[model samples]
Target: MDAHPGTEIVIDRDAGPAGKLAMSIRADRAFALGDFRIDGKLAGLHGQAWRLDATTDETTLSSSDLPAIRQLSRADATRQR
Candidate 1:
């Protein structure tokens, strides 16, 4: 996501669930949760924005990345990363 950003992503066993992370997730990015709480970090976060945006309503900006965030399945939500 850092290299090229989109709206969202899904990870099953196919996406290499665990490995040395390849990219940095910006703080603007976030995790989209399922009905239940999940124990994993949102990978490819595209959240590496360390510098804050000017005039960004933090509350609103916090969720701005929602389109790119994906929810974990009920089972995946509880699975440890």
Candidate 2:
């Protein structure tokens, strides 16, 4: 999930009950939640904050999702190479 250089990736957390939902970004497209995975594209990042677009296969989601956005961002960052 390593974001491309100069790409913006944002993962927002603390918005659900499970407290473990997140979004992934790459470029212009985004992945919200799908078949057990959420993916997105890089939008932008400022300081310690990241801005990303959200997109997914599933049409909708419940209030509680898994893999907080923050965690997803962190994982993607770590995956960066």
lDDT of 2 by residue, 1-81 (tens): 444443443455654565654543444433332212225433222323333224543222222234233343344444456
Candidate RMSDs in Å, in order, are 11.9, 11.3
Estimate candidate 1's alpha-carbon lDDT, on a 0 to 1 scale.
Answer: 0.30
In angstroms, how far off is 49's CA in candidate 2? 24
Assess candidate 2 and give its TM-score to the true structure: 0.24
Which residue pairs come into collision in candidate 1? 7-67, 7-68, 25-47, 25-48, 26-46, 26-47, 26-48, 26-49, 27-47
> Any runs in candidate 1 off by more than 4 Å, and if so which?
1-38, 48-61, 71-81
lDDT of 1 by residue, 4-78 (tens): 242232233222334321211232344342222334433332343212333532212122232233432234444
Best by TM-score: 2
| Predictions in order: lDDT | 0.30, 0.37
| Candidate 2, backbone clash total | 23
